[model samples]
Target: MQRSRDGRCKCLSKVGLSWKGSVDEDVVELVQPLTGREQFFTASSCAGCIILLDGGINGFEVQKQNRCWLLVTHKLYVKDDVIVALKKANGGAVLKFEPLVLHVQRQQLQDAQILHSVAIDSAFRNSGIIVGKRGKTVLAVQSTHGLEVPLSHKGKLMVTEEYTDFLLKISKSKNGGKQEEN
Candidate 1:
């Protein structure tokens, strides 16, 4: 069962289904080292991302069901890019930044716990372990570093373009996509 789960993850990655199509460049280095380790394999990962979402009444906490991706990228962006993207917001437009996130499958529960503990200790406050019914364990490394800024209301830009530029720069610096010490 353990071997099959590991194989399943590898096959998914090879078939380009994990990231919807091919691996994300943002997390290549972060997960590359684990590829050779027989006991660990990545299920999915995204180092960071900046997304312009067309959300509705819920405001910043955009629901997955109703939100639309107006603009999305896993790479750092400049002010002008965001400014241009903001022009298309229909309603409750939200600009959000999400930090590194990784799901790793391990051979044993202890391995998952160790990785989860290290991730949590290293400022990945949302890190945790998942125990599957098949006795497969997965370590989810996630962070609390995320930002959401509402760009418009009712299809009209709410803030000046200059402010939008500043916010974009802030989002860029807050990406935290660089390789970590671990």
Candidate 2:
């Protein structure tokens, strides 16, 4: 689980937004316009996950960090320059890129459906949008493709580069087309 400050995320505070850290930079860029319409609010998110352990492939050791979320978002439009600041803040703690996952709270089933449609349209590929208690709908959106590797190895940064490029390419490809527009 990621850390939250007074029921808010510290990441949100660093960017000079509201105290709640419901959304991070990358997500803000991806969903700012929708948020402005008050259709939904993000509860928590994991842009990706990373874990660091002391063991290699041969054996096992203590896990330094277990399932840490790289980014979390809410509703504020606090952009940290495309998550560059968050990455920089991560320092050398990150070890892998897990699938992007988001938990969102929507106003209605229609809003959730709209978000689900947008998420699938954006190539997320794996989304579990369900109606929770009290008319609140939650969406768990995840990406099928991601980079997973130990940072101890050399050239790992190259893998990160490649992964980032891949995500951008797919996102752009999905956004540039009108498959459902006819």
Candidate 3:
């Protein structure tokens, strides 16, 4: 899954997964699987783009925009042999790189520095993060009441005994469910 910045909001985008021995061209042919069409948009030699439409069959409509000239062509029935070979060459590059795209997008949003983020730890399923521009904090809200802590501190950091006591109370309440489960 990939999310791209669309104005103020983020949008999820989809890309095809290619098998082994597939060339750049073959991979391009798998873009959109509903239309049974393949298309390419190449802005430069190093950075060429392709779109696959609909379902399986190797034919493609390619657009090549190079430094010197622009070329466009449509071909039908790509050879299975070529696809197999390119698949081997390309290997798992797409899969490895695809997840990072989503990660980078999320990181960009987090790093924007406008707002802070609070991520709940997997162990504390009932807890969540609370963030704001001034400072971000994480709190556990239980049936009774709860407390929160600001994990980030600028300049110097300090921990007080009262805060530690409050944290212990929150921890006990969070663990109360587990005790009952056992």
Candidate 4:
């Protein structure tokens, strides 16, 4: 048998959890279970995080104001884990919370569809699918729960815990089910 030129292991490369940089523990714990399965793999992910920048969008330059992913995950995951990950957000130039965002790569279209259904069940909305550069079908999963607050207010964080909690409640209520008018 002729050996293949590609050195990467097909089995391991397409069926494991991977990250671009450091990730939150909560996210890791949440994703670990999925990576063990045969049909999916995580490419990049973030359990919604917060960041601050010195220069405001209004063009004011200060110290070290920049956005950072408090948490990131690149795999199939439960949307609630993103909100729960926010528990790690504390004491920084913390400005806002970005809801859980995931990029999952599936073995094929059917796999993508299955994951999409799973995402919907987990309260994730705005689910989309695309063929990756490597010819893999990838699913973009998202939760509507997120926040962007003006950190320019006296160089301090204007976002409050109450506001984030409210966003979470709204997001949870909107999960793939029917909405009720108040």
On lDDT, the leading prediction is 1
> Looking at model 3, which ten-residue stretch has the lowest summed lDDT?
93-102
Candidate 4 residues lying further than 4 Å off, grouped into runs, are 1-23, 56-94, 153-182
State the local distance difference test value for candidate 3. Answer: 0.23
What TM-score would every model get versus the actual structure? Answer: 0.82, 0.47, 0.16, 0.53
**Residue 78 in candidate 1, Cα distance off native in Å:** 3.7
lDDT per residue for candidate 1 within 1-182, as digits (tens), equals: 13455453452245332554655676777777765567787777777788888868562566646787887787666557777777877888888888777888788888888878889888899898889888888888888878888888889888998777666666666665333221
lDDT tens string, model 3, 31-129?
223112111111111012211111111232212222111111112212232233223321111100010000111222333222122212223233333
lDDT pick, better of 1 and 2: 1
Best by TM-score: 1
User: Clashing pairs in model 1?
Assistant: none
Candidate 3: list runs displaced more than 4 Å.
1-148, 177-182
Candidate 1 segments whose C-alpha is farther than 4 A from its true place? 1-17, 177-182
Model 2 ranges with Cα > 4 A deviation: 1-22, 54-95, 149-182
Worst 10 residues of 2 by lDDT: 73-82
